[model samples]
Target: MKWSEICIHTTNEAIEPISNILHENGASGVVIEDPVDLTIDRENVFGEIYELNENDYPEEGVYIKAYLPFNSFLGETVEEIKQSINNLITFDIDLGPNQVTLSEVNEEDWATAWKKYYKPVKVSEKITITPTWEDYTQKSSNEIVIELDPGMAFGTGTHPTTVLTLQALEKYIKGNETVIDVGCGSGVLSIASALLGAKDIYAYDLDEVAVKSTELNIKVNKVQDAVKVKQNNLMSNVSIKADIVVSNILAEIIVRFIDDAWTNLVEGGYFITSGIIQTKKQMVIEKLENQGFEIIEINELEDWVSIIALKK
Candidate 1:
């Protein structure tokens, strides 16, 4: 069998949404190669940091590679993906070079190619995300390891936004708190919340694929009893009052659901938001403040920002 490798030269800001487009178009696997990964000083406190090849990354911006089975409808699917990606600009997302190319590859090569980019990394003080294929043991009893199969999903929980969100979750969730994970891609946050001692968790995502992906991952982490997966728009018709509401999505979408989030949280409950670029940080902060949320902490990783706000 043969697979077509589609590579897109795009910006960091566009990674999440563009990856969603590819996933929607039936991409088998997605690999993101960012030059920053080669230069960033990762703290290998409890896990091994895999070596990255400099030549595999783009000189500017980033390359998103996806594999799709070569078939008769391949051309049409690619066009749909291109159009969907181009539509992102209306949301004020920067597409960068936005150059896309394709190549032919054998099935076996592309099947495992994306795995090399993944490894167990401690995203937060207590949480380490490793692919399901890796064997990771906790160096300390306090350390939490999340097993994820990210090939069928959008996020592997290693991105800066996710890391920041996970770190905030670790800090806020003491124990027995009810968590609402808005836009819970790959169900990583929900699983982390459960592992960190949240008694009950409700995970929601608009995309059916994401909903399924989160469900699968939650079971893999053996947190199914604590986490409930749902397919719903962000906080829409969600009346469950939560101790903490965490969302790792676009800033534009995050601001739209401020009221919903407010209503869904108990008084003094927390709202954790990420997937916000540095340029949009002020906008999100202002929105949260205007909604009567007290900004507790704003952390940045690789120019990506995450905010922990208290609903006072």
Candidate 2:
């Protein structure tokens, strides 16, 4: 069996919403990423595992998800996903000038072509990601393991945003603390908080994919006991308060979301936010400061940054 991948570029924060739009329109599952991890899960002899896979992309990284039905035409489902996403979804296919793109399937004969791309990724000094099929070796007796397969609603460890989030998490999360990860993509930050010794980690996102992906990832990482993954947009139904709130969102959303993101936190709680480019860092800082959250630390890696603050 084969599937035609539909590549669409949209706001990173909106991918989850778009995935919901696609699922409602008849797409079974979607792979959402900045560089577009077309394949997130790899089949194995034992069962299944999660890992990244290779897909070709030309200029302007995509937040792509492929949808297909065994008996459907490529344009049928593709257009549905496109329409649901509306102007938020833009195509690589340009109608003017002589550019037309055709749908293609994976040339690999093996059913589990995605397995080849599954490999270990370093998340932090004590944490590493391994696909479920592979054995766990070289893990320290006291170290943390976050088992994840590539099939998730959000980007994986390979992305710079995730890496920067992990780095900030390592520094900020601590023992027995109550934490919340707003816009918790794939539940990585919430899982890391649990691993770093947070007791109660409440995570939710606007996308149902985020809720589902986070549930899967929490189980895979064995942090289910510590991490509570739910589907919510900025703490709609969560009754408990948090000592730390971490949000990885676009700068504009960060500015808009901090009001609610902070409302759920305890007075002394820390709010760590990323997905801010250099151009928007100052605006985020000023916004957070205006909210009365003292700026404790700001980390910059490449063009990405994570801001740490305390509710005063």
Candidate 3:
């Protein structure tokens, strides 16, 4: 069987949403090649080795690849994906370059091409994300491991945005606290909350694939009893107050829910948000401040920023 490899050249800010688009359009797996990874200092802690070749990455922006079976409707599907990506501009998402290309490959090639991009990596002080196929053992007593099969879904649990959120969760989530994860892709934040001793976690995502993916991941991490996965648009219908609310989504989407988040948090609750690029950092800060949130901490990794605010 033949497969169609759809490759998109876009900005880091658009990676999560575009990956979701490919998954919803029936792509089996997605591969991301960001030029920034070439310069990341991997000290190879815990004997983990990284094999990255700089030649494969684009000089600027990033390349996102997904595989779909070559079929009669492949062209139509590709066109729809392009239109949907172009539509992101309406939301003020910078899609940098936005050049898309396609190629044909054999099924065998498609099966193994994306595996090399994924490896076990420790994202935070206590949290380590490992691909389901990778063999890794905990190197320390306090290390928490999250096993995931990204499977065309966003949030591999290793992105800087996610890493910052998980790190904050580790620090802020006291035992038995009620937590909410907005735009919970793959349930990584929710799962990390549970692992950190949160008594109850509510995970919400506007995307159906994300909801299902979160459910699957929660079960994989054996935290199904602690985390509840649901499909909801931000906090539109959510009324339950939480001790901590974490959202790793676009800054624009985060701003839209500032009021909702403030209303849904108890006094002194923490609202953690990521997936924000550096340029929009001040915009998000002002919105949070206007909503009466006290800035607690602001974290930056590469061009990504994660803001932690307190509802006081």
lDDT of every predicted structure (CA atoms):
0.90, 0.71, 0.90
Estimated TM-score for each candidate: 0.71, 0.64, 0.70
Q: What is the lDDT of residue 79 in candidate 2?
A: 62
What lDDT tens digits, residue by residue, belong to model 2 across residues 1-312? 665656565555565666777677677787655544444344331122344434454334455555464455666756655565664436432312211223556545434565555666666677676666668786577677767764634554545566777877787776899988888877878888898899988888888877888888888888899988777767666667888888887988888777776788888888888889999999999999988889988887768888888998
TM-score head-to-head 2 vs 3, winner: 3
Q: Which segments of model 3 are wrong by more than 4 Å? A: 1-104
RMSD from true fold, candidate 2: 11.3
List RMSD in Å for every model shown.
10.3, 11.3, 10.8
Best prediction by lDDT: 1
**How do all the candidates rank in terms of TM-score, highest first?**
1, 3, 2
**Comparing 1 and 3 on lDDT, the stronger one:** 1
Residue 241's lDDT within candidate 1 is 85
- Find the 10 residues in a row with the least total lDDT in model 2: 93-102
Q: Candidate 2: where are CA atoms >4 Å away? A: 1-115, 237-239
In model 1, the clashing pairs are none
